[model samples]
Target chain A: MATTDKRDPRVVRTHNDVPAVALRLLLDEGWEAVTPVRVATEAGYSRATIYTHWPERIDLLRDAFAQFSEMPHHEASGDAELDLRGELASFSRAMVEHRLDRALATLAERTQTNPEIAPIRNTFVADGERPMRHTLRALAEDPAAEAALLMLTGMVTHSVLMHGTPPSDEVLDAAVDIVMRGLAQRD
Target chain B: MATTDKRDPRVVRTHNDVPAVALRLLLDEGWEAVTPVRVATEAGYSRATIYTHWPERIDLLRDAFAQFSEMPHHEASGDAELDLRGELASFSRAMVEHRLDRALATLAERTQTNPEIAPIRNTFVADGERPMRHTLRALAEDPAAEAALLMLTGMVTHSVLMHGTPPSDEVLDAAVDIVMRGLAQRD
Candidate 1:
């Protein structure tokens, strides 16, 4: 008889508790502070349990980032300009809400010296860039779309880092408007 | 009779050698690796000699960054669009040649967690931003100029970080063109 007991409480706890705790630590203390032992102590799990699931620290960091990267899907509405604005709005909002600028800046610093972490950081960037790229392609062709996407991201990052605050909605709108005008002129 | 040698060879060497070594360490090893002790060891100067010039680690980092930030003055060719293009080219070229992306990323990371370093970082950013803001204001008004400047920086940064190379001349030209058109449309 195949029996499903409400799943072992330990397994259930590890599954839910680990990532939640890891994310909280990451947000509260920055990436450097999110160590396995600290996460275990905070989450009330043994170190062995964390190690068993994620053998590498980067894996835990990646999991936290992955959770951070998850956002409502940005579907294009056929109006290229409107779509771009929507994407930019969402991006700015996410950056502020999640403190992604801080996380990204930390990872960017690490990637400069730590080759092992570069691919993981790159994956995080690429994943975040995917939807924007799609929306850009829907509006423009290859090279231009790619450049526009990069510029959009750069603008968002620059705003956050320079001001130490998430870009306001008005700023995001102005940026998208300018970029879109530029793209339209390109065509 | 008191005689002054043109400049003591050792004094000149310390002045020249310290920053050169610090910059090298920063580029090669990331910002964390560039410490007063490491600079002294690499430059063959006593820690006291290095400390005499830069009393604090942030001061040392700032001096290295200031040296890096020195660029040939970009003269506007009377044409606002052409001038913007020229500025973008210089910005892109400098970012690649000096590996400014890595340095800026590391500084950005530090600024988030270390309040002591934030002012120095802000000063660096402000200095870099001044010329672009001037060009932008020349093209448009206050708020638009501000937003355009931010987006321009963002695009350049994004290109370097994502591609691991400075943006090519073609890309810079295209970005400048798009931005110029957008500015024109704003008017």
Candidate 2:
């Protein structure tokens, strides 16, 4: 997977640029739209260049997914309440910015008839859920990590995607307050 | 539209049966597959009869949506906690039974490029959200109703659609507890 010249900035730009193009198409159009040829055209790379790096549609999708799934890391403030609120708010913003709801809903739709794509979505969700779960595990135990994260995801995603807007701070505060309150009661 | 013979059981069956056939197609194949011709062929009704009732694709989609959107009612037990938990658990079960997550995610995907289809989702969400709001409003007034509902929707949907299973009772209990705790803290 290494570029021919790792030290060359030009090669490095191609490494990132091609996948970003693929990711854009993947998000805007469904997976079928993302091909090595299309990525080369969009990214100003030769088809041979893209084919050399990504030989298959899945390779492009997986690489594009790596970009599609990027999240701005949240530095935990030691205040679980603030941390959770910040995480959910950032998620709402990201969904709107990336049209992530469309991406995810499309994934959900595809997984119905195409079972192989489930892993793509599972990987995407697991990457995001893994870290958040670590911070949230303190709220109760293992199961709470899952349930709480799903709740926050639903809250943020439903509002952003369904309503076509990010949730208001008022809703965010209440949601965060609810989770924290649930944890506090456990204590 | 009144059937020619409103009292005839065969006429009543045709009235409900045709739309149900359209609904099945809409849920399984997305909106484009549901048409008057498809419904007539599936329901064994004459194409002319179907056209008489549903002259356009929008007519078919709207009628199909009405059938697609039916939900079983949950009665309140005068215990808010029990009511909320029961509601969420049933939602998870219903989602599985109806493949509701696919239907909803498809609606979500369609709403992206088709502004006209937006009201279909809005009507669906509003239908589900309205009564839940009445019960959840007891927690922290207006805003909590919306936020809490979204969280619950997310929790159930992420589990059911993404993971291909419903939330476990343990997970459902924890989610309900968290929101209730948030409400108690506010009080």
Candidate 3:
């Protein structure tokens, strides 16, 4: 017999199933190709169920992004500056390598204008900023920590977002070196 | 004759008038509200004349952005690092203060997905990048100039675009201080 609980296991399973199936459809086709009715049919869920979980298309897309945003955080290995650089490079590479990056970026940009989506994006940015801040505090001397943190994230994020091609390893390496030099502590 | 040798003064006057009027409408009502008909009626020109001059909406928008982009480049004064900081703060302030920034950002993001507009956006970015690169080279030593250049623009643009609020003078000052310290030549 299926166990009955206030928060049912099946409901959790269903919630997980919806996004996984929706993402598969997104990856195979493109953003424009996916529609709520189609996603429901593909996911084997009723349209009402999909709506119950995610009221809007952007809501579903935001959930999909959450899947990747939880990617394993890069741990800083003792030396703070080096750890910061390596982590930034890794994060940049992860973002660029994902097939869904462009779709996600388009969504992120649209979120700025759409009232429903903006706060969700602000939360994501704040979450990203936190660990980097922690890493900088651990590694950088007090005066340099916050600035270095912003420059590192700004450079890496911009490089990934703006570059049409995945940056050559050499290019990313050069970018990291340049940022490091820029953030070098002063007297 | 007001002027009639090589270039007709009246034609020059008409050509300049189109963008100036278009820019006014854009700033007042937002870019979404702009239309060829609106521009023509407001500028006291015929719809056909506006069409003949621009041929496309993208062309009109691009020229408007370019006109603002070409405003007198500020010469950094005082210490090299201080001067660079001042120049960056001034640039960020100008961009954030401009009432049209939110509308321009909306258009820029739309271009990412709208195939017809993407190339126009890319061209604008490349055009903007050139002057920024030149400015950075003059401000900093060689190896890290490009990163310094990229970060300054990226941070300012993204901050305004994402936050939808002009950074306070103090915040801009903090950003400049941090970035300049990072880019300063080390002993």
Candidate 4:
């Protein structure tokens, strides 16, 4: 069964279960409130089993965030603005729905002081930015494309963190329109 | 003479000197090494005077960061790439020359936990990002502009914090060239 389980359904389920339980703990309480013991007990797993998979809470979290940043869940619409808006909406909704914003913020703040976590955090940023880069590159020349990507990411991050609400879908649509139209080749 | 003495140019110099001394102490040693009494003594100011202005050591540090972020010390060139390169260079040099990266990182982490300092930190980010937004707007027609900005900022920040050195001037120039060319309007 172990050999047949190359795509081991059980292992996949457990791996998936770990992050979900951890994320819920993070969102329901706060980052500070989560402990490996708590997570393992909550997930109905033994402490040793959880520890065997992730040596520490930080390792588990690093993996959880990596999973969170993975691009596939955010399906791309062929339309650039639509795609971008949908992706951002996914981020915003996740923040509000899970109440994960505070935990996420805590993770970000820790990146500055904790050398081990900083690279993991940077990796998350790089991965999240990839689709935006690809979309922007196709839309305009380098300088313009680069600026648009930064602006979009920065604006989205700032809006969510500062306002605790994503821009209205209408506002985001307008922003995408302005950005895309602005980047369109001028005579 | 007491009233005039308080208003003396020397007093102005003395008031301004406190933060400078604190900054030097922070960089020369480390943030943990800094104390309000030490800063006051180093600046040759009375503890009462330092307290009158800044109620806490963190308040003093936050004010220093605020002053530093706001100073119109570096001018941006009209050309987008040149302007960005200039800004990045100045920031990198400042971070590198004083060996302040660790201290600043520590302070940034403290700000997250310290409610009083968090707003000050946010203000600094908002202010620093304002010029970048203007630059992005001007270059909006180019899709690459936005991504270029993000990458460039990421590169500079990463280079300094991770690599612990300012990138060579040649490298900075080349990065600017690549981004500018990448965003150049399609003929």
Winner on TM-score between 1 and 4 is: 1
The DockQ-derived docking category for candidate 3 is: acceptable
lDDT of 4 at A178: 51
- Residue-level lDDT tens digits of model 3 in A7-113: 77878877778777666665556555456788889888899988988898877766665665666667767765566666766666666566434544544455544
lDDT (Cα atoms) of all candidates against the true structure: 0.76, 0.76, 0.61, 0.61
Candidate 4 similarity to native, TM-score: 0.62
- Candidate 1's C-alpha runs over 4 A off are A1-13, A72-79, B1-13, B73-75
Score every model by TM-score: 0.85, 0.89, 0.77, 0.62
A173: Cα error in model 3, Å: 4.2
lDDT for model 1 comes to 0.76
lDDT of 4 by residue, B1-187 (tens): 3555657676677667877777667656655555778888888888888888788887777656655564453486677766777776776676656443554454444443456756765676566556655665576553444444444554454444433344667656655554454355423
Candidate 3 regions with alpha-carbon error over 4 angstroms = A1-7, A20-38, A56-58, A99-108, A141-143, A160-184, B1-6, B21-35, B70-73, B99-104, B115-119, B126-132, B139-143, B163-187
Greater DockQ among 1 and 2 belongs to 2
RMSD of 2: 3.2
Residue A94 local lDDT, model 4: 62
lDDT digits (tens) for residues B1-187 of candidate 3:
4445567676687778888777767666656656888888988998998898889887777666555665444564545556555665665656656543444454454554566665655665565556556656775665466666656555655555545444455544555555555555433
Task: Indicate the residue-level lDDT of A74 in model 4.
Answer: 59
For model 1, what fraction of the real interface contacts is kept? 0.62
Question: Residue by residue across A1-187, what tens digits does model 1's lDDT show?
Answer: 2266578777875776788788888878887779999998998888999999989998888787677665665677877778777777777777767777777777777777777777777887888888778878877775677667777777887777765665666667777777788888875
Q: Tens-digit lDDT track for model 2 on B52-89?
A: 77887777777776774567847788688898887887
**Between candidates 2 and 3, which one is better according to DockQ?**
2
* Best candidate, lDDT: 1
Residue lDDT tens for model 2, A39-145? 88889999988887788777787778778655685677877777887777777777777777777777777777777778888888778666567668766684676
